[model samples]
Target: MTATERPDVRPANPHFSSGPCAKRPGWTVKNLENALVGRSHRSKPGKARLVEAIEKTRSVLGVPADYRIGIVPASDTGAVEMALWSMLGARGVDMLAWESFGEGWVTDVVKQLKLKDARILKAPYGELPNLADVNFDNDVVFTWNGTTSGVRVPNGNWIADDRKGLTICDATSAAFAQDLAWPKLDVVTFSWQKVLGGEAAHGVLILSPRAVERLESYTPAWPMPKIFRMTKGGKLNEGIFKGETINTPSMICVEDYLDALNWADSIGGLKSLIGRADANTAVIAEWVGRTPWADFLAKELDTRSNTSVCLKIVDERVTALSEEDQVAFAKKIADLLDKEGVANDIAGYRDAPAGLRIWAGATVETTDMRALMPWLDWAFAEAIASLKAAA
Candidate 1:
């Protein structure tokens, strides 16, 4: 096939960005008609809506009975910052980095807080640090999924069951689509706009009993911002966990999340969500297996993320070019797909190595994924022909 030849079919829905990802199949603005737009989030009805979101999340994800789940301000970043700022000083900390977001957290711990006892465990993109070497005696901070690199920890088995310190996980991209080991994680944070495909700017913060205990006992050396404050007068602010937000929230976003959660429940909850994502990833994996030009960025099968499936161009014609040309080549393919309206926002993250990043979360239909495969092939062939013509 040449640049002039195109695929016969295009993805039914082309909203495949890794964040603010594709909405649940059949999602519509009309579904959000009941959003409490004019009402205060703290109002009786509004808080009930918020509580419903929380309880439904717990019920769907199987979060423990003892864990406290709260709707926090900002996205996953805010939830992570709250945990890092409020919980790290009490013990030595180990920070892990394999991708952009993980590197950002490393900067927060080492540069922002300037924790003297911080130990950094890092790996190049597409790889994971040695999980067995992690020091459980020190509070550990890591991303459950490396969104930029499409890598993830295989499971929570590496985390010690009886660790002395907390495990704070930034799980924005992993929630719903992946199984999170709740007991192994003391503090886990995710945003509404990730796998569930809800609106952005709101984060969910889940805390185990151990995490709450740390909040009650340990205070950070730096001053806590109003939004990061989870405790008051040395006791956990129980209301936050019960739908009383620390700051005003957008009721519309809340309503959107509620709709997504209800959709998740209706579709057989977490098991179905995971199966859908797995099926979507399998579509890409099979395509990559047969395609000569592409390969997964993740080095290992177990570590590859089902949500953010990153791929690198391996065609010698492209890889033989200068680094800048390689990036341009990858961008050309992404642009071609976008222009064809078969895919959108499929380019690799800016800081990540130049490649393709597809969101194969539960919300994205596998049929759409199967349809998008040929478009990718067409786009790559078009890019290669353009490259030859330019030469």
Candidate 2:
């Protein structure tokens, strides 16, 4: 079917932006009418809603019974920094870097925390550092999925069953779209704007029992920031995980997030959500198979990401143009898609070279993606021909 002929053609459905991804199916402002707008977050009703959001997320995500879930400030970055500042100094650290976010953490470790004995296992984008080479005995930090490069760890089997270190994971992009092995992770952090498609500004922190023990017993050598302090006087502040946030939160945003969680439940939870992501990505995978100019940015099929599917144009005809010209041509096609409203925000990440990055998260409908693919081919052909004529 032509892209214009498809009935499911929504400018919103085939959005495919990396973060603040497309909203949940049937999401609307009317769904959040009773968010206690005028009341304080410290009020009884507001606190109750906060607690419900945490508990429901735990149930929906299949977090272990022993884990504690909390809402934190600054979204995913805040949640991760809280764990790092509160727990890292007590043990040696092994920082893993495979993409932009991982490299951001490495910068935080060296420049921000100034940890003297940390070891970094680094790899180029689209590849993972050797998981087996990591020393689990040291506190470990990693991104479960590299959203920018569209690569993800195949599984969590490399984590030792009885390692002494705490595994801190930034799972902002992987939360609802992939199965998380809670037993293999100690501290996990994610933002509402990711898979859930809720508004940004808040983060969720899931702490395994071991992570709590570390927080209660060991303090970092550096002074604690007010937001990062999870314990006081060497004792865990259990209330923080219950509903008592470190600071105020947007009740409206909380209500919206709860709505997202409820929608997640309605769709048969994570398994079904994963199925949607897989199906949406499969549409792109099939397109890649037939298009001569297109290839996956991910090096290996097994490591290829189902959520953020990035593509590189490899056609020699396009490559015949100067490098700068090729990139400009690619940008022009992306702009055309955006202008026609056939797709929105599918440009590659800034750090990466010219290409397209499409988010196939659960919120995206596969039927819409199927309709959108042909339009991409048409736009690319038109843009390349124009560039050649100009040259």
Candidate 3:
């Protein structure tokens, strides 16, 4: 394709960002007009909004009735650290990492916490760690989807139903779009910025009956920060799960989340949301099937992520270059697309393998994804030609 052979159709919205993702299709600040911004989050109206967000999340995700869900500070990272700090020292632990965020957790557990009885399971940027080797007798921590790698756990089939220890999952990229195995999972954390396409700096923590029991039973020797505390005396902090956050929350962000939740409901809730994401991915999959230079970073079809779809450039001209040159070439393609108003913030993460990572969550329209395909083809060809000219 030549540089001038631009596709006639364009994505109506060029917001394929993975985090703080594309907002609800028709979102407007006016939707959050009654945000209770001036009121304290502890006030009845503000608390009611927070509770509504939690209850709506519970309903949309089909979380177990007995599970406890809470709004927490510092987004998904905060919620995950809170769980790790509070519950890990009780027993031996297994940590799995395949991508940037997962690796961050690994760093925290190994370097910062300095736990004695910890096993690390690792994989490269585009693959998943071996799940079959995981020890269910010990607590297990993993991400439901590696946002940077675009590789996700195929399903919860690998998890043991009767495991003695708990499963702590960072499902920041999977919550509303993926089917979480609630019974097998003990603790789950996700941010509002991903699939819901809402505000950032806020996280939701979901815990099962087993997890709540752990909170009641175990106590870490380390000094737990106030933001990470989820227990009072010897029992669970029931109020936190009931909209009593451990710290102050942004009421406007809470309202934004509520608006996204209502949008999910109007679109048929969880099943429909998952379907939309699946369809968006299917579009890219179809495009990749015929595109010679591009392929999914995830080697296994089953593990291919339907949300953050990481793609590698395999065109010989590009791959023939050194790794540094390959990165620069990929950046050119991404930059050209951005300049053309074709897509925004679609670059692969700093820690991820050199490639393009596009967001394919529920908020993204299928038509837009289809439109973006031709542009991707154009960008690759154009970038390669320019790279050769420079060479």
Candidate 4:
């Protein structure tokens, strides 16, 4: 366990933050050279680029022909906020929270929106709330994947096929790497920065026919902001779904996303993307199987995420330390890896328990994940040695 004995092979690509994840293996700035930089987004060519992005997204995600998809502002957060503000007041809502982002939505429903009949369902960082307890009679809001905790719903089997209320889902981290049951989901939202590794500040909002019906038929009691408004004069605004954005957009970022979509298409579409993510997680799973000190933060294997794979240090020596000391020890491991240029931003989310969180999405290379395992071992040994010296 000598800290001095470092691994000779390093990951060729070391950019693995959960968001703004690793780009396609061969991506370059030169790829965006044809971006419509100086033109107005309202122009014919500009709108065509936006339309192409939407069309490609629909094709790759296998969204239904009857469903509507729009690119929105403020990334996934904006898309989720728009859905919550515009639709939740129409019915009693079920809000589920198992991680930071899910908890944020709960706060908005209870504190901000002040919905009287909202039911809060919660679980700790390593687990999920009871799916059986959710009342499909009420509008349901939940995350398909808990990014900060690395736990996700096993599948969409629990959702009722004949439910009366709309199901709003914030699926920013789950869209590409996992299967999203579109029939069960009424409102689905994701960002460009996640599985596809494109730039941020934009979100993709997909809506089933039922969700559109809710928007067109019922309006929230609260005043809707201009960005959140999806209807005009008691009808759904058809232009927004057709790439006519409510506000100006970054053409450069749109081109980057198009490039990412083109890459996904070239590599065999959604099936290939899911396979890549699963393979990356398998590499980490193998490492965790033999390493006594490292374990998944997820409590159940069925719910474990293939994309944002979180790990907790279970070594007796480290666990015996004070809570603050344990956090510092985890930081030390991450810092060592950072200093050695083997990994970056592998530290867990600030609100979660002290651990490592690695991005294993479609864009991350499996070879890099294999290369990362030995470095993690080296870093953990070094951190433990440092603790003994300090004591």
lDDT digits (tens) for residues 65-164 of candidate 2:
8899999999999999998888887888999988888889989998999998899999887788999999988999999988888988888898999899
Candidate 1 collision pairs: none
> Each candidate: what lDDT?
0.93, 0.87, 0.92, 0.94
Counting clashing residue pairs in each candidate, in order, gives 0, 0, 0, 0
Best by lDDT: 4
Lowest summed lDDT window (length 10), candidate 3: 1-10
Candidate 4, residues 214-304: lDDT per residue as tens digits?
A: 9999988888899999999999999999999989999999999999999999999999999999999999999999999999999999999
Candidate with more favorable, higher lDDT: 1 or 4: 4
Q: Which clashing pairs does model 4 show?
A: none
lDDT of 3 by residue, 51-145 (tens): 99899999999988899999999999999998999899888999999998988998999898999899999999888888999999999999999
What order do candidates take by lDDT, descending? Answer: 4, 1, 3, 2
lDDT tens per residue, model 1, 300-360:
9999999999999998898899988888888998998888788999999999988999999
